[model samples]
Target: MTMPDINYDILRRVAETASAYRYKDIWITVGPEDGQLVIRVHDAKPTCEDCAIFPIAKVDYGSSPSVEVATIGSESNPVDLLNLEVPAGQMIPAGTYAADAVFWSQSAVEKFMIPYYASVYGDQADVVVQTLLTVLKPAAQDGSEPDPAFAIAHLPGSEYVTLANEGLPHLFLIRQSGRVEGAAKR
Candidate 1:
């Protein structure tokens, strides 16, 4: 079994996009199980205590993280667990490949945490979005060479839009069905 080479920047960009909507934390997980590749995003919960309605009231508090995972495989070799196919012509080659997972929190306090005396608290969303966009553009440009046996579709029932482009080799946008199709060459 081998792991695929994952571009961390791309993963981080995806996480950042997901975090833009007030998610607590965003990170990526890449691993192998039963001769397959598994990718996951782990979203954390906010850390701040809920706003108090009554001055003397105590509110029960705890934080829990949410996780979303997607798996990919070859078009003809769909991953049974995820029902996704791999990109065309690319293979794992039976070796360990570099993988990266980044984690960051998006709590309101964490966003505005500054010295009590500091006069500046800027919105970090723009900065985060810019950085994420920069990282993602290159991957999108290089979409031509993605492994044929691997493809990713947004998790069902999630707000994420599926990614695909006409110029992307072995990848197709199923416009009518709104799904990404992979055509891997044997």
Candidate 2:
């Protein structure tokens, strides 16, 4: 299969936004929405009382990086970001964890997330990535899926991980580990 044509700059911008806001944990996801690649970032704090606590920014490809600059390109196919709420009490169906191992194994994880965090977080990116890997890798090996309550981290530091968007179809998750757990609009 042909690899998804990912615009890495867009991912980097979202990562920068999360870092700028100093979110302890963040959820990032990118996928086709209305025929264009839509990326969303959310504060992944388990107890976030309101979705407004998270600043949602969406930008088109090749646009300047600014939370205020929502529209980066011409009127056609402008990147539209939706205010996606993190999951609260929804039930994640059993076997949701089945495909994580295959998804995380691809170069996409590094090609997508690791470098973006490295660029945005600089020296601290290692710790962030390590913490993520340390937390999620064992589950991958054991074939145990992340429960709806399984958060990668919740402390006040740079910690984030890319997961399959639970809001979209399972096929999307099978292809890319990009969404924050339960952070997509269902």
Candidate 3:
């Protein structure tokens, strides 16, 4: 099947709503013409000269029976900006998928997340937490699962905020398979 047409206005709204709850510098966007989704983190350069932003996406497929986290962009750009983009065919299959992502700085993860996970996993925390920062390919096309070694955390209520919001910039995605969908943020 072909990739579906995306509604980017909804993605902006989702980012705006999530921006209120947490980080304001982060924004989520989708390229309708290219059929790609992007999560961008901006304005870190002035605050921290050595800071880098990471967008970690956790995707949950409802029509199908699987949940997966596919990291598409992980390159460390200069401390200013970073964005994670998922091409439609590679990351999202034909089924309906609900995706939510968090934009965390490298320093934040090093200072907070890694240490916290380290307490639980011991020496493996550094390696274990890398799962959240690693670059991952999409699940195999032959119905095989993505790598089981890494587990990415799901950002709760993010997808709901994107879909349930009744205001303008509502998501109105129409898939080729006749399903309607929306993007998410957290």
Candidate 4:
């Protein structure tokens, strides 16, 4: 059976709304994995510059908020992001997946915020926070779930965020002893 296609129109609407509201950066990608539909949004980048310098920042830069979303659409058996799970020992299947990532600088606020107006003009701070949240909500919606084909592993800090799409489960193999290994063969 064919998986239900993601509604790009809805995605476009969300993107436009996010952009109109000054979300700044927005993207949408669609693909299939493990015989299931995959829809993902790479809405925002890491907040810290020290973190963003490296490709594998999650490992290199310690911990930061890395937000992503995935969804599987099927009429009879639709699956939400939260419900999906990575298999116990498997790797994410290879496929042509699309990703739209928005990378914005925090320094913009620093540059724009002059010392004199810092107290009175809090609107800038509010807009930045709101835009980030707005752009992230759709991705954080129930539709996005990690593909079960991959594994799920936690990072160093108490708040490490890794999406199944990035091969987290296989990348960081958590042993029974609670120590994490760098690689796990799929």
Question: Top model by lDDT, which number?
Answer: 2
In candidate 2, what are the lDDT values of residues 47-121, reduced to their tens digit?
A: 322112234443334543344332212365332122112233321222122121122333444555557446655
Mark the regions of model 2 whose C-alpha exceeds 4 Å error after superposition.
1-15, 18-85, 88-106, 134-186
lDDT of 3 by residue, 147-170 (tens): 221122223223322322221121
lDDT of 3: 0.33
Model 3, 13: alpha-carbon shift in Å?
33
Candidate 4 pairs with clashing backbones: 70-144, 70-145, 81-144, 81-145, 151-169
List model 1 lDDT by residue over 76-168, tens digit each: 543332333323422122211111121112232233322210221124344433322232122334567353212222222121222222121
The C-alpha stretches of model 1 lying farther than 4 A from their native spots are 1-25, 45-170, 175-180
Candidate 2 TM-score, true structure as reference: 0.28
**Local distance difference test, each candidate:** 0.29, 0.35, 0.33, 0.30
Residue 3 deviation, candidate 4, in Å?
A: 11
Error of 1 at 2 (Å): 15
User: Which stretches of candidate 4 lie above 4 Å from their native place?
Assistant: 1-4, 7-22, 43-186
Counting only residues 3 or more apart in sequence or on different chains, how many pairs clash (N, Cα, C under 3 Å) in candidate 4?
Answer: 5
Q: Which candidate leads in TM-score?
A: 2
Q: What are the candidates' C-alpha RMSDs?
A: 17.4, 17.3, 19.0, 19.5
Worst lDDT 10-window in candidate 3: 77-86
